[model samples]
Every structure is written in C-alpha cells, then in structure tokens.
Target: MDVRLLEKEGFAGLFMRLRAEGLADKPLLAALEQTPRTLFVSAAHADAAYQDRLLPIDCGGFAESADLVARLLSLLSLEPGQRFLDVGTGSGFLAAVAARMVERVVTVDRYKTLVQLAQQRFAHLGIGNVIARQADGLKGMSGEGAFDRIIATCAFDSMPRAFVEQLASGGVMLAPILAEDGRARMARLTKIGSRFEREDLFEVPYRPFIPGLAAAL
Candidate 1:
C-alpha cells in the first residue's frame, strides 16, 4: 500500500543502492524490497517503518534495527539449503528474509502474541519454509546439532551452553552478549570441534532475554 514513508525515510532504497554497488547481496536486496516493513509496525508508527531506526511494534519492545539486521546477515554470508535458528523471531522480518535464502528457518520467541503475529505474517506472505514457535530461547532448542546458522535478537548475559552444543561444525552464530555490568555487545561465534571461538563485532542494545527463557536453560 502506502510505502511513501519508506520511500522518504526508509533506507531500503539506499540498501538497494548498496546492492547495486556490490556492497550487499542482490538476493537480500530483493527480499528487503519484497517484504513491507510497514506491515510489521503498529498503525501509529507505520510511517516510521522504512526508516533505518527501530520502531515499536505490538510489544513493549521495538523491532531490530535495519542496519543491524543487514549487517548481521552480511557477516553471516548465508547460503541456500542451510538450517537456521532465529532466537527472537520478533515481527518475523528476519525470518521472512531468511526463508527466501535458506532451506529451513526455525525461529522462536517467548511472547505468544508476537509469535501469533509472525505466523499471520508468514501466512500472508506465503512463506512456507520458516517455522515460528513460542518458546524460551535461553534454554536452547532440543534439536540435532549441525545447524548451519544461529541468530539471537535478544541480549544474553552469557553465551548459552546449549546453543553452542547445537551448532553444527563450522556453523556461525550471531548474538548480542551482555557484559558483567549489563552492557550489550554483538559477537559472532563459530563452532570448531568441541569449542566455540568468538569475535567481538561492536556495541549494541537489545531487550533482555525472555524471563523463562533463561530459567529453562
């Protein structure tokens, strides 16, 4: 419908320009174009959908920053046929994008309303590969290790041991880890053998992990 706000303030156009300049993947650019951010945000803030900034959605928390999402995806260098786990599905924007590039996307969030909205969005968009569920993310998913990629949108005080155990060899996980003082930082962890190596990327701010999420772990 009305993408005027996105045209005026949303950096989608700039992202496309970057894609054209070869800074980003062409397919990702296409997915961004295909998904309407306006639909993910509340009606009051719908005009802010296209902006680079995060906008408040149905929950008390806001959506992830577009720049952060794009940057994370770029760092992951996703490949088709990979199994992906998204710790916080949020408005399902990232999962929707991943659905286009990955064979399967398993995303979870603690909030039932958020999951329901995401599911509705997925249905509306005709996305079939992504499975969105309402579950605690901190406890780690009980699935076969060997996931090609794992992403966490919520801030974690410590790297979840379960997540590390579930990562496939050479799998990469993008997460926001909190410092002892509660400051948030983004890092990329890659599993090698029985250990995982971490590379600090930059500072970030994200909502704390869901309450029961960490308790279940």
Candidate 2:
C-alpha cells in the first residue's frame, strides 16, 4: 500500500463521506490530512481522533469531530491574510487545522488547563500562528484588533453581541445558537457594514456556552 494513501485513510474516509453529504470541501480535506488530530486527542479517547466522532478532552469538554469542524469552517469561507478568532480552544484541534489556511488565529478558552495543554500541543506541532489563552469568550477578548472571521465551538442563546461587533466589516462568524423552543442550530452571521445577515444552518449537538472564566479545573 502507498504510505501517502495510508496516511489519508483516516480522515480521507470521512472526507469522502462528508463530500457526499455536501459537507466537505477540497481545501479543508487537504488541511485535515496534513494536521495530526491524534496529537490533540485526549489519551483516554485517542481512538476517536480521526473517526468522525467528538473526542472527550480534559475539563469535561469535547473536541468536535473532524467532519463538524470542516462543515463549520467551510461556512466561514476563510481566506488567506485573514485573522481569525476561535472561541473555545478546547483541545485546539480546530485551531490547529485552521492555522494552515489563515494568516493568524487567536483562540480563547475558559479553562486554564485546556489553555495550557493546547499551547503545548501548538508548540509541539510547531503551530506558531495560534494564540491560545484563558479568557471569557462571551465578552470577547479586547486589544487584538478586528478579526476577519470568527467561530465559536459551543452553543449560545441569542447572539454574542460583543463578538458580532468586533468583526471587521464584511467579516463572518460561525456559531451554534439555541432557541427558547429547545431547538439548537448552527448559524453563520456575516457582518456587512452596520448590520449582520444571520443564516441558520443545520441542527447541532454542541455544549452550551458558559460565561466567565474557570476559576479552577
């Protein structure tokens, strides 16, 4: 068997499945194949790294599946020379995958443990463009300048007004929003001048966004 083909067999299978379901795009597939998801997978659940399943990480959080990550990223339509903000660094798998496609990435997580672990992964993998820090993502981090694209890994009710306002004009944000009716769905908000165009996408099973930073854990 060809070694290159063997390396892609993992997400490569997922890439084809997502493509058939209209979820995968070519560039994202390439990026996924290049990124080592195993490095970010929690040791206890490393088996799910490239298996199209959410991996259980530390601090009771979950790392989204490669397919879900690719689907959300495709919605962002990321471009070169773009500064992206990732809310909820988690295991930093998504941020690592994204770093290859953008100019820079600022990813924030509430848990200090997650932040420290993720930073170590980024350094081990030689991923320098991502800035992983512990912060309150609900309010958005300040002094980072404007972002061309942003993505939240968790679910929220209503909109993240602070993050919406921080986007550069014409910037795009991808997040999962929950409604009062108990229905939750993914949404893409594109900022055009002073207003935002909200487009709700598929239903998702993401953890609700928590406010404030983790005092411990």
Candidate 3:
C-alpha cells in the first residue's frame, strides 16, 4: 500500500468510530470529512488532530476535540441554506466544519490572532461563506441577528440573553451551559413563539467564553 493511502485509511478508521457511536448524521459527517482537521491546529499537534482530546491553540486557548465537536454538531439539526453563528472561534475548527454544512457562518473570537489564523485556514480550504471577526461575542456580531442557528464553542452559566434573542423564530442553538457545580453541560435551545425551550444535552469540559478581546496578544 502507498504510504499516503495508509495514512488516509488510518484517519478514516478513527472517524469511523464516531459512526459506530451514533454521531453519523450524513451532512455533518460529510462536513467533517471535507475539512482537514490538521489545517486548524499547529503542526506539532497535527498528528493528534483525529483523536478525541482538546488541542492547545494560539492565544493560550484550546480547541474542542474533533470527537466532541462532531458529537455536538450531530445533535444540531443542521440544514442547507441556514445562516449559522459560531461564538468563541478559538481555532476556527468548528466554524470551518460548519461552513461546509450550512449556507453561511459568521464566527467570532476575542483574540485577533485567532481570527486571523482561522481566516487563513478558511481561505486555504477555499471556504468563502465564513465571516470571522474579533469580538466579545456576549452580544454576538452587531446587525447579524436573527440567525437560523447559533452555536457557542465556550460555556455560559445561562444562554446569553442576546444570543437567544438573536435566534430566528423556530431556530435552534447548541451551547454549553454551566451546572451549579461549575461543570459545563451541553444545552440545546429552540426558539418558539418568542420563548426558548431548553434541553440540557450532556456534560463537557469546554472553556468559558472570555469576555474581552486581547489588548496586546
């Protein structure tokens, strides 16, 4: 077997387990397969990109694991032509994967370096529908409201009021909400008739949404 083909199979085999574990939504899987995880992380961590563990990214933050990211997305009922908003753009990996599954994705981060790095990765992949910028994300991108879907890569004690308000009527949001004990649990919120129905999904170790942009990083 060719060395490159063997490497390809190895990576494919790792992702296959996600299918067996029931994270096998077709469009989500296709998005994952389409984006190369290695492009989102530094070369030192490229070899571990397919593993289910958070990887350190620039600006002293971490990117959620590929497994967790896939699982979180699998829970989202993603559809084509839906406008998506991603908060806490960290490595931009989540936004990159999602850009493949939706019409347009606007991702925000607190660090300028992270945004720039993610933008480069998106361009390298020829992904054009993502609008990444440096922002606090507590209020989401100004004037980008009423999105079809919203996802926050970090955890919040409660769904930011602004985010829920920004979700279009009948739209869905996937985020991590902190429990009393401070562990973050995945929560799914659906906008219905000006009210949101919340469903706590599962426990996760995602970091909190840092409140401000880096002044000098």
Clashes within 3 Å, all models in order: 2, 0, 0
Model 1 lDDT per residue over 99-134, tens place = 888899999988878888999999998999988887
Candidate 2 residue-wise lDDT, 65-174, digit = tens: 88888888888887779999999999898899889899999999999999999999999979899999899888777889999999987888877767767899999988
In candidate 1, stretches whose alpha carbon ends up further than 4 angstroms from where it belongs are 4-12, 16-22, 213-217
Error of 3 at 101 (Å): 1.3
Q: For residues 1-217, could you state the per-residue lDDT of candidate 3 as single tens digits?
A: 4434533764597578897797668788778877887778787877777777888988889887878888877777778898999988888888988889889999998899999999999999999999999898876776875799888877887766667678888998887888788899888899888778898888888876678888986
Reference-based lDDT, residue 11, model 3: 57
Which one wins by TM-score: 1 or 3?
Answer: 3
Least lDDT summed over 10 consecutive residues: which range in candidate 3? 1-10
CA lDDT of each prediction against the hidden true structure:
0.78, 0.83, 0.83
TM-score of 1: 0.88
Off by over 4 Å in 2: 1-7
Determine which window of 10 residues in candidate 2 has minimal summed lDDT.
Answer: 1-10
Candidate 2: the clashing residue pairs are: none
